[model samples]
Target: MENTTETTKLLVSDRCDVCGAQAYMRVQLAGGELLFCAHHGNANKAKLEPITLEWHDQSSDLNQA
Candidate 1:
């Protein structure tokens, strides 16, 4: 996958790899990308964070009205 910045955000159509829920976080590894919703993102953060190349998180948007 290409390198992306914080501005390179995910669209609403992006789906989580774990449960097909709307994806709000993208975990980029050397091989590929892994998408996750807020719940799964938080759940797998510990394991994924160490090996992650880039963690594009947008779960903060969930708090907005």
Candidate 2:
């Protein structure tokens, strides 16, 4: 497994990697970390892999269940 704890530093610190806007979702992958503004996260989810880690704050869609 990759050290996402360390990779977190390499990911965008403040803004979304896709649109460079305020990030509403944080996409943590095995090999890379990504910060996505709500638009991009929901927009590109078809390409983003789902994660198993516990996210303190998660997308409302999941919380609905």
Candidate 3:
């Protein structure tokens, strides 16, 4: 069996579930997924990481020119 993973990039249209800012991270929980901006993502990391199944962070893209 071959293991394959599909990666999806966060689009500019994706907004944070909290403040509506541009989303830079995607947090996947068993129930569903949450989109977060850098601020909320960092702030909630401690509380959410434990329950998150997948954390797709693209905050580094902010540093790119």
Error of 1 at 44 (Å): 0.6
lDDT of 1 by residue, 1-65 (tens): 76655456887899999999999999999999999999999999999888999898999888983
Q: Compared to the true structure, candidate 1 yields what TM-score?
A: 0.85
lDDT of 3 by residue, 1-65 (tens): 54332255788999999999999999999999999999999999999999999999989889993
TM-scores for all candidates?
0.85, 0.55, 0.87
**Per-candidate alpha-carbon RMSD to the true structure:** 3.7, 7.6, 2.7
Candidate 2 structure, TM-score to reference: 0.55
> Model 2: per-residue lDDT, tens digit, 1-65?
89764443322356778879756566666766677666787786766656523221234433444
**Model 1 alpha-carbon drift over 4 Å, by segment:** 1-7
Candidate with best TM-score: 3
Rate residue 28 of model 1 by lDDT. Answer: 91
What's the lDDT for residue 53 in model 2? 39
What would the TM-score be for candidate 3 when compared with the true structure? Answer: 0.87
* Regions of candidate 2 where Cα sits further than 4 Å from its true position: 1-13, 50-65
Error of 1 at 13 (Å): 0.4
Clashing pairs in 1: none
The candidate with the higher TM-score, 1 or 3, is: 3
